[model samples]
Target: MPSAQSAARPAARSAAGVLGLAALTLLATAPRASAAEGWSLAPAGDGRPSFYAEGAPGTVLQDTVSVTNSGSHPVTVRLTGTGTGTGTGTGVPVTFAEPTVRVPARTRADVPFTMTVPAGAAPGDRSGTLLAKDADGRTATARIRLHVGGPALSALTVEHVAVHGDRITYDLVNRGTTVLVPKLAVRARGLFGRVLLDRAARTLPVRLAPGTRTGLSEPWPGRPALDAVDIRLTATAADGAHDTAGTEARFVPWGAVAGTAGALTAGAAVTVVRLRRRRAGRPAEPPPTDTYTDRDRDTDRDTDVELTGAVR
Candidate 1:
């Protein structure tokens, strides 16, 4: 038979072994509880990637954002909208039906929002992002694009045209509502109907935004030195935007021109004086003879003698 002390020792060892097994199980499951699955936030539709709305200025557009909790606990998020994409700023007006939303575990919450196009907003495409942020600072973004309804006019003009030595400078103004990548064609004609420069339409390096003006220049390295030239520039953009402007420039070597003019004036004066002297030194012609009979000849001699005596 075993001793009583040996029996007690085996019982104590069994209790310690059971306690260690319980500790191992708790350690394995604690991390899983603390770090649970996360949630997702996006547009509400089943197959939609983002939200897009179109309306005129001062119109209100509505959309929904879906917050889904895939973890085993509820999530709370604060929502906001900010302007994004091409011609919008971050301060666009956006209002949420529920700024703070609570999504239950393994479920989703759809929140509605309205975005109003400004009363003075120009006609074009604007965009923004719907932002959802949790207390833990985790963020999700849904994109939104809004197209303002109006007549899309593509108007542009080339202004302030000037020629500076070997370059042509001008300003491009976007008169209507839209962006423009302008194509420029330059033509020049000199005196005597001669074509000095002809350049085909080529795209410019700058982009013009709606209601914006940009200054630009075109190089004219091969300009003529002695002629009056008419420089014409035509600017065109997509959607039939067109404008043309012209400038006239005259180039001359003043010293050479002045010298030639002086020489011609001096030669003309000398020729005039020579012609006057020749006319003054010429002799007069004698009277013509007449056919007369002998009796007529005798009467003419007597009249001449009487006229001489009366004069004496």
Candidate 2:
């Protein structure tokens, strides 16, 4: 037998409790509704500002497409490509295996895809798209253009490397390619041991031939004690404005000189010892003694106990 007011109080509290529970449930699910996933695709322009490619019939189709992430959260991207079925192609050989690849906040990455047209591919002109996605399930795409002709007379090579006092020297080969000329640059850095070298802004002005190699010679001053590898040499070549080939050379340890010195000293010592043994037949020196020898007996005792003072 409860009073009316007391009963009312419990009912009110129950209603309030229900309302609170409902509010919490709404708050918990709200994020899913507002959260968004996306990425952006922009045209990848070569430094030269050209966006088209030229390939003739009976040529291999090869080109690169880059996709970047313009998002706040990481996303996954799977790359599938499409183009006019004129050329027999392995469309986009490399890509983000999904709708999105995880791109960290405020960072962009390049996705490279190679399209190889069969020898008989109908290759007057062809195009495709490379897609990039972030984990958020957003998408981005880059356009591709290609031209096929005679063997792309592009080349790449590395040479002229010298190791001087903890430094290395080298050259890059223009191992030929069909369409693009690789702009070349060189760099030197120390191992994980953070030692980055100051490189000059110099570019090779020659169009390296299909069989010719580029020469690289620079005095890269590095840190005092380069622990892991004194200097790391890297050569970058760009074909049609894309970095195509890169090579690295390591410095030789200067300790080799010390090793050479030690060996010479040891050899010289052995030679001297051998010479001394060969001269062993020479007369030997008499052994040293505090006591007089028989020949010097007189010095020890008078030749004859001289009759002192003639029988004084």
lDDT of 1 at 115: 75
Tell me the number of clashing residue pairs for each predicted model: 0, 43
Clashing pairs in 1: none
Provide the global lDDT of candidate 1 against the true structure: 0.72
The per-model lDDT (C-alpha) reads: 0.72, 0.43
- What lDDT tens digits, residue by residue, belong to model 2 across residues 22-60? 110111211111112444554332321212344444333
In model 1, how large is the Cα lDDT of residue 58?
Answer: 76
lDDT, candidate 2, at 130: 52
What TM-score would each prediction reach against the true structure?
A: 0.58, 0.28
> Once superposed on the true structure, which residue ranges of model 2 sit more than 4 Å away at CA?
1-38, 43-51, 56-64, 86-100, 133-137, 150-312
Candidate 1 residue-wise lDDT, 1-312, digit = tens: 221111232343355355431110111111111112387766654446666666677776665666777877778888888755475222346788788887767777767567787876667777677778888888877666676777677899999999987999999998887778999999999998799999999999987877889988999999987999999999999999999999999999899989998887777677656655765787864553575567877996997677545433
lDDT of 1 at 160: 93
